[model samples]
Target: MTDQAPAPAINADRLWSRHMEMARIGPVEETGNCRLALTPEDVEARNLFARWCREAGMELTSDRAANMFARREGRDPARAAVAAGSHLDTQPHGGRFDGVSGVLTALEVIETLKDAGIETDAPLMVVNWTNEEGVRFGPGILGSAWFAGRIDDATLDDIRATDGARFAEEAAASGWRGTATPADLPMEAFFELHIEQGPMLEQAGADIGVVDAVQGLCWLDVAVTGMDAHAGTTPLPARRDALLAAAAMLVGINDMGRASGEDARVSVGRLKTATEGPSTVVGASEFVIDIRHPDQAMIAHLQEECRRVCAEVARRYGCGVEVSQRFAIPPTAFDGGCVAAVEAAAQALQLPYRRMASGALHDAANVAAHAPTSMIFVPCRDGISHNVAEYASREHLAAGANVLLRAMLAKAG
Candidate 1:
């Protein structure tokens, strides 16, 4: 970190204005956006972003995954670019700042440097990763996962969107897909600026959150089977109701999570019964359990406990149960250097900040596998996010962006 170098101030008004402008592409409830990945709405957002980047004198490029990169040349052309960004796609009912702020702040950072006539040793890049919300696509953070080599080309191309469109077809249709791969545009470091998405920072009255880690997540699929019977004819003691058994399992799962520890999180977001008729007992039931923890071992332990609870509940209710692991992302500890750079930036700026772990999964988690990566979180009102009411004050956003600017400068040098 340079103590004497002049610090260029980011245009807070411009950043806020850009967010308002992007929200127009897929307007929802005036404050919400529904731009799903690879949709026409998403393409429009990308095009507008590209236009802004070009106007800022940054060259635009995209990879096979359609991860858009806006590059500003540095003093050394050969150095790997120091990157800052987050995904641009929003949840079906997402607020404006979740992923949008990261990409915009990255652009804001470089633009500020340009305004100050200051250049770094390595090129700076602003990235807009694709399919981060995954509302239209199946798995979230699709772009960064591919860039990190977690998903192969064939698998990526074969993926089908919820609207019956193939991933490859949609990427090509967007006109942003290119032959560039991660190998072509390497990164020295990646910083993702995002809303806290949780209430800790705002409740604590902190100006910034220097994120040090991201929690692990796991999904489990459970299927309970039993014979359907006439609701009126079957006696309560003789009936083997799959739905009833599933309900019991749900309660058991919640109880188990509560007993494990405060950090453990278990939730059942999706559940279905084979029989929807009110007069008939459900023959089969299925549900997905979402489990998360900051500790990988705790995640595993919690997973096993859930399985045991389901099996025991099934046996008690005379139903057959099957539990299988769907997918799991282990807890990620960010690079020490990257974490320190963000913390140092906060210290240099003399902002009130705290070192915290992200409770939500982010594209940075996948990027961390390939590059030195960390995140800076701005406090959202009431710690609310992913909702129409989601908001980060201009002052807090500016404070976080300034921290991001300093962090990127430290890494780029």
Candidate 2:
């Protein structure tokens, strides 16, 4: 590796302008975007991205799942491409930089190389994995999951969006879907440049983040049952309120998470009761516990602890409780060589950075199963994401793109 930085560095102004241009297609409140997968807004955004790729002299291809790939030819045509990018689809209330940064910054890298007339030993690619937000569809990261062989073709095709649109039908309508398979476009390495989506780098005053792992996640569905009775007539000592038991379970689960350490995350974002009337005692309550940890073993332990706490809390309230796992994703450790490339890029660029684990799941997690993959994170303002106020400054984004460019070059060479 050379101590000197590459010539024709990423253009901060151009990158920021591209972000603003894409944000216009699905504009929301102020700076937010809402380009749900396969929707009209998303199609427009894809068309725009395709146009930009064509303008840059990159050949664009896509898969049956509607995942987009733009390739820049290299000296060795047979070598697998070094790929980079993230999703283009946004959450219903996502900000401009969440997934957009990954895609645009990748394009910026390719553009910088093209302008400098530099070619590598392996081809370079920019990808836009579909349905990553999964706001309309049932599951997120649908595109990468299919590409990684985790989901079968029939199952992926049959999935219906919340608005009743079939996945296959929508994909066909988007006009970007094709027959390209993972085998057809092999990857030597993949890099995703994304906003931190959390406040860590910003709080630490860092310029870049070298992402090494993604946390595992588990969801437990819990139910508490009790006999309904009149709120006024039921004696406090004789009452078996399911709501009360569930409330106690929530507190216990939170405390368990807190005690587990800083890496542990447990949350009950949704809850429901059978009875709503103030005069009637609730007979049934249901809630989901979201548990997460960087270690798979710790996730299992936390899940079991949550179940035990719910059962004990139910017994204390004279209620019957049931806890079942909804789903779980094992923690993902990125490719070591790719991770080292990112770290080395930071060091070479003289950017203050930290090696960190991603708290939220990303398309990079799925791609890791199929290829040597890692990620670069630019700090967002206040660590906020999935909201209209999500933000990353031009300097930080350009910094991340430079790291991505360097890392991709290292791998491609």
Candidate 3:
């Protein structure tokens, strides 16, 4: 048997510079990024990634949903490819490294492997799953969802961005329309490198995190309708205000999640009131509820509680209530063998590491439905994410990339 080769070290300066350059594309003053999916900024970012991949001499392919893949061919063409990558889209005030790091780090891994003259038994692919942020279209992991067959082309056509641009139009405008479907390529294993997005790794003094599972996410649009009236003329007790009902439901949501346990999280991130006038009581109000828990059954239980509380709040305000599910991604656990591969790689590098659960949903969760998959996390400062202040240190970035390199090598070899 041939002896296994040692993985090459990642260049911290190169990685840091790549991250900074990408950050400049959708630069925001508050250190938050703003590259919405299928926007001009998103186009620029995708072009830049394509340029980098081409310079590395990797074969590039785009799926029908515009998911990008840059491949490094292996000695054997018959084996399923080992893949690593993440998304390029960002939240309204997103940070530089959230999804970007994973894609860039995967590229770095390819470069490092090539430089080391290492050839694997299976081809290596760096993936850029489209709309992983779901910032523009209201659904995260759109590309991965399509890849997993959880979503279809008809549904993709119906999705519209915040600006009312249909997904099909934006996809065509961005020049990413491809014929490759998800079922066309099957992966041997998949890996993603991402920032912890939470404070777990930092608090534990670990450099890398081997993610065990991603919490299940439930998103709902709650609407309350009531009679509009003069704010001053209607007595507080007599007024049937939709906004009041929404407020009550929001408070209840917080209480329920907190009481559920440490793993539970509930957020009313977006809210809208129909009556904008100061003197008019709100006749209708709609808000989005985002709840997550590591346990699917527990999340189901929490959803029922949320529904009951919302109904009661509406009754108290003499309003009609409606709840529509926007998106629901069940709790996903990483493949045990893939987890073992990541742990073994981290141990080989002597990096301080811990096994953790992901609080935020990721493309890996969607892809896991179709293939063996896992993720590695580096610490972000203070565990802050989805904001301009999200950050990961250069040292941690290098360490995480190195771990990714080893893990990819293990799977591909």
Best by TM-score: 2
Model 2: ten consecutive residues of lowest lDDT:
1-10
Please, what are the lDDT tens digits per residue for candidate 1 over residues 1-413?
Answer: 25687588899999889999998999999689889999899999999999999999999999989999999998898999999999889988889998999999999998889888888999999999999988888788999999999999999998999889999999999998899989988899999999999888877878999999999999999999998999999999898999999999999999999999878899999999998999999989999999999899999999999999999999999999999999898999999999999999899889999998899999999999889999999999987888988998888888989999999999888
* Model 2: per-residue Cα lDDT at residue 192: 94
The list of candidate 2 runs beyond 4 A from truth reads 1-7
How many pairs of residues collide in model 2? 2
Top candidate, metric lDDT:
2
Q: Report lDDT (CA) for all predictions.
A: 0.92, 0.93, 0.89
Point out where model 3 deviates above 4 Å.
1-4, 30-32, 157-159, 162-166, 220-248, 270-288, 308-327
Clashing pairs in model 3, backbone N/Cα/C closer than 3 A: 31-388, 32-388
Per-residue lDDT of 1-413 in model 2, one digit per residue for the tens?
A: 23364545888899999999999988999999999999999999999999999999999999999999999998898999999999899989889988899999999999998888788889999999999987899789999999999999999999999989899999999998899999998999999999999889988999999999999999999999998999888899899899999999999999989999989999999999999999888899999999999899999999999989998999999999999998999999999999999999899889999999999999999999889999999999999999999989999999999999999989887
Question: Candidate 2, residue 201: CA error in Å?
Answer: 1.2
The sequence of per-residue lDDT tens digits that candidate 3 reaches over residues 282-338 is 999999999898889988888888898899889988999998888787899899999
Cα shift from native, residue 311, model 2 (Å): 1.9
